[model samples]
Target: MAAFRSVLNVANSAKLALSSRTMASHPLAGLLGRLNHVAIATPDLEKSANFYKSLGAKVSEAVPQKEHGVYTVFVELPNSKIELLHPFGEKSPIQAFLNKNKDGGMHHICIEVRCIDEAVKAVRDKKIRTLGEKPKIGAHGKPVMFLHPKDCGGVLIELEQE
Candidate 1:
């Protein structure tokens, strides 16, 4: 009787573990925050900025990151800024994604978070594939990491914490 009880206990524990795993893997589960910005790839940063400004985005100061070979412009909307990314190099990741997608439209959506490490851990624990394992510096000098589109439907999701 004692051995049977032990076996039943182990089985129950295994079932609980599996249930947690299922919840973690759910598409909508483990979402810690909301969208911060929507990034759009443009061949000309200034042109895109002007376009957005005309739409009442209140564009901010233009900043250039030579290391990543990108010229970033921000348009501050009521809630969030629409990030305009201009690729200065052929190897820019945004350029690659744009080329592959071949759609002149919304690129990636940024999500704001308080704890980047915790956010990344949650993503990993859920077995969601992420691009950068560790947080890296991003546009506007913010700490950010990208979750591959494969894990977030067909839209690239960037997690940002400043």
Candidate 2:
């Protein structure tokens, strides 16, 4: 009887733990802010940026990220920006994405968060994995983290400091 009671208590505890975070709207919703940017993987960053420019979009200069092995550019919009990404080094993470996409397309979307640490914790508590390290400095020079696509409905989601 004691063992049965112990097992029941453990089951209830597990149920509460999962429910506390998975309930309506999610416990992490409050941590997410506005859409910062939508990233597009491109075989040719310059060409893509120019295309947006032709549409009257303000495009920034291509910035090569050696550590990340990708070149990046931001096309500024009224509410957000479009990030153009291209492979720079031999081991660029986007290489596989480009190989599969050929012409390249939307890769991910970045969202603003007031506290990166809190955001990470919230996602992790829900059993979602962060792509790389907890937080790395992104193009905007703000601490950022990425969530694995499998847990995020097939779209890579990036969280950045607001």
Task: Give the alpha-carbon lDDT of every model.
Answer: 0.79, 0.91
Error of 1 at 62 (Å): 2.9
> What's the number of clashes in each of the models?
0, 0
TM-score of each: 0.74, 0.83
**Model 1, residue 47: C-alpha shift (Å):** 1.8
Report the number of the highest-TM-score candidate: 2
Name the lDDT value of residue 31 in candidate 2.
85
* Residue 118 shift from truth in candidate 1, angstroms: 0.5
